[model samples]
Target: MGEPSVDNMFSTASNKPHSRRKRMLSNVYSKSHIMANEALKAQISTIIYDRFLPYLASTFDDTPPTTTTEQPQTQPGGGGVFNICALLSATTMDIVTGYIFGLNASSNLIDNREELAWFLDLYNSRRSFNFWPQEFPRFTAFVERWMPGYRLSPKWVDEANGEIEKWTADMCERADAQVSSAGAVGGEEKAECVPVVYQQLWKALSKEAKGEEESGGTLSQQLRMSLASEVLDHLAAGFDTSGITLTYIVHELSQHPDIQSRLQKELLTLSPRLVPSSAPAAIPDPKAVDALPVLHAVIWETLRLHSAIPGPQPRFTPAQGCRLGPEEKSYYVPGGVRVSASAGLLHLNEEVYERASEWRPERWLDMDRLDVEKKKDMESRWFWAFGSGGRMCIGSHLAVYQMKYIVAALYSNYSTTIVDDTDIEQSDAYTAPPKSDKLMIKLIKAYT
Candidate 1:
């Protein structure tokens, strides 16, 4: 098919009430929805920090070496094989699932080779094929089934959805089993559960299934499946974005020794270091961590420089078209036209930023330097890290929290200097990572 016509691309079914599912999906893109999601995310994040990190640290033997002075010996000729993308992807997914299903049902893919491989295969394929389905959902769904090479045909989408449904159902079944076993024994021994979210979801489904509420009567099997689909979307989105962001942060820190040193100094100010084992079992209180300005700024700068999903955030022009640009000069984009603005492009706009192309954290430090009008512009339209308006990232707050902890933990315990800086440039994928698999950094332990 030729490029979709402007009319075809932006066509809204005239006079038809928008479908509720469509409205729900649209809400996912809104700012209010994102803020509400952050609260759920924070609860899940605590589990990740308290339980998941320890498990990963132990599995990877990521313990800092005993001595600060000595460098850990490397295997010769085996440089740059560290697949930072895989590490970050697995880490993010594990954390996200922990939040979604509770710790009991969360994935342990970080150390589980087979699971990790399956996940990456699915994830990579989905990312590569997303644009087609998103752009022409109805047509793509039809053609994909019969088409070859573009393997995300209708059959593939069905299979993917089925797998996700089965996975979520299994979690629900397991929770039910635990609840039943506990009930049998006078309900005295509560099973070590994942989180309350899954249990709550299970109860809701059970009530709906029993036809206990008339308003929920229409929400039966298909509805449950749709909810499952949304959950999967959330998990997939949370994982990939966080993973890619962390990969870039690591690359940047490896390149900047002085910045790394200063970050380490800030981390040391935490009463007990932010090291994996140093903290209490739970993550430090979100409020307390959020208060650290330096930690917040470092994460913010890294996010600004290397937004994980840098592609255009697609939004269709409203019917009757809309005005954009400085003078509100009407461009007359046809209704149903797919138009978007990229954070990658916006973040690097030379007008709003000095040395826009340079990776300077100091730009973030001096907000006052810019003239008041420029600062207003920057505040209003410049920063698009988490995105702006209603459709921003839902788990952005939790992502920030995870990134800070990861950065703090790494820098506070070890000093990193780049081993192969040339290969550190990002690839051209939707979720970019270092072009070279290895982000070889020599780590020197830090002592306060």
Candidate 2:
């Protein structure tokens, strides 16, 4: 309710503080580090092989298995239509929390359908209420404290925050326990048992943190709250953003069978294709996955068309005055001015991107034909899915890893048919998902 303390790296104002916070865990978020992280690898393997694939193999999970009322012929599988949107959300939450608190202690939302449903229900409900408290906290607080019965958000909003905060606190405590008992033998623990980010942040804060008054809590207490604040944001973005992107990727690929087939072929080229049986113990080389041109194109094209955070990323102009716009007609603007740019608008620029509104992965693949400047403009300058500069999404590499792996696993083993995509168009919001918030798909298992 109070807006998790601004100490989280993304919301912090000054560059100095933000950089310091980032330095605490930047190394591990690097692609090299994520690929090599034993915990992540083990957890991902379990999620795909043990959890996800089995769930899909069930063909369909028709609740009640029978109904007197007529049901839509969403899929022929007969089990029932699956809400891929909810599944993707659950998958992301599991993976991100696993990375944060270690898989042993992280959520089993992927396996617990009921809990997964509950979590998403609570989480998505609050998205609409974030406007007041997030953008104008002081005003929101004033209304609540003075204007009796006049609240910007409902009571359930605070209740949802409390539930999520409690969940995060439990994970933080588990991470603390693991760190306290860690020793040489800790390395022998299960690969996914190591809480990497939590351990790093606690160690850094323990050494540097000196006073209780700064955050109105003792050193260890303050550190725990800070850890909760930071990781919660990371967990939210790490899952939601990637989940949205992957959902759109699946939706698009299903609509374009040829493109989906081509991407699957590309995924299969890896030494260990994500097929569960063929390579039970075979995890594809991260480098190989990263190198797949078609896979890259699909992801990039989806990001271009459906950026999760399609809204503006606001930035304050520097303290020193600077020119505002076009060099020829630019006028000086004072510092601290709120300036913003929209990834959604940039990606739709027709001059920079031919047939800008179309979902053409070829645009990325065909970039070699363009001159360097044009290529840069099309690919780098306009693309802002993860924002830019020091404040960019820190877990971006991990998000990419999870999305790519999940996609590879899915298409490698099954062909998806879009069952019902009514209201699939994205909502007009910062972290936009389909306004309908559901994507029914039929999973046709594939084999050689």
Candidate 3:
């Protein structure tokens, strides 16, 4: 509520200052940079190939059942099923944090399940509480101040938030140390230590520092908190939304095992395949993964159907009054009114997407069958998984890269089958996940 720019995700923060922030680090997040960055590739390889694969393979005691397609040398976990939702959440955190804080300071949640549980408990369990503070902050604060023991946020929530803050702060300090050391850590180690975003933002903002402000002054504190807030918000949004989308991908693919196998074939075609491995592995070029039509279609379909933030993204009307709706039925609406477009509704338009309710990745790939304009409308107009315009989800590209890689690595090694999916229909809210918050899935290794 306080520093709304890019820091406070909710507020319809202005574009001028937001642009400044974007300029500082947009290159760091660009497709070219991400694809070419050797450090990022190594970080991803370590987290995914080395850590996630080993952890997943260890979840089973018995060999996996062969698929209906009869894929050979498959190993499935006959042992008790694990929560794919939580596992993927941990995976997202590790990957996102590695990219954010550098590999040295990033989370190892994949290897450390207990801490993953604790962090998710602190982060996920508190979603419902956000409605009060986010929607009706003024009224909520008034009630809490006037009435004794009538706090909207429970004491434990404050404590939980403090823990999250502490966790984020520690990462911030470590990233600071890494970037301060500059090129001291050379070779593969240097790549792992590059605090990409942190270093960029610090340098950009440092140019503005007059060096007159004392330690912890309004300028210093605000600057520090702003960076922390931006990174942490990105951290939460990056992991949670991408994780939920990926969970849905696996769920949809599990239900349609044929689709899973089709995807697996596409994934295995890459030069540096993401095979099941405990040893260090090479990460394929981001372009290679992005170029896979099947993979792209599946990711798009999942986002269309299961957008993490399908809710209307609130936008304030311009001060100059604007026309509303189509030209034929347009009306002049006064400025300052809050307006929004919902991806949930936009995506379900029957005209834009045939059998829109259905999970069909072919619609995206079946472009030749569609008229050019129709295809354009579907891909550009109807699709709003990452929102639209200048203030769109800043981490959209990063999310897509992470998701594609994660999905690629996953399907390349193992085929997932739904063990138990109670209440898989997503929770209806700002950042939706499964209502049950658990998509129990069993994994089986699939040999190429």
Per-residue C-alpha lDDT of model 3 across residues 39-142, encoded as one tens digit per residue: 67778888887777776675664554332111111235255356778778988998888888888888888777667778888887788788887777679868
TM-score of 3: 0.89
lDDT at residue 239 of model 3 (Cα atoms): 94
Residue 365, model 1: lDDT of: 65
Candidate with the greatest lDDT versus the true structure: 2
TM of each candidate vs. truth: 0.73, 0.91, 0.89
For residues 305-356, what per-residue lDDT tens digits would candidate 2 score against the true structure? 9999997888888999688766799988799988888899989999988898
Look at candidate 1 and give me any clashing residue pairs: 10-336, 29-391, 30-390, 31-390, 80-438, 102-195, 103-194, 104-194, 144-153, 145-154
Please give the lDDT score at residue 344 for candidate 2. 92
Specify the poorest-scoring 10-residue window by lDDT in model 3. Answer: 65-74
Model 2 CA lDDT for position 415: 87
Q: Single out the weakest 10-residue window by summed lDDT for candidate 1.
A: 1-10
Best by TM-score: 2
TM-score of 2: 0.91
What is the model-wide C-alpha lDDT for candidate 2? 0.80
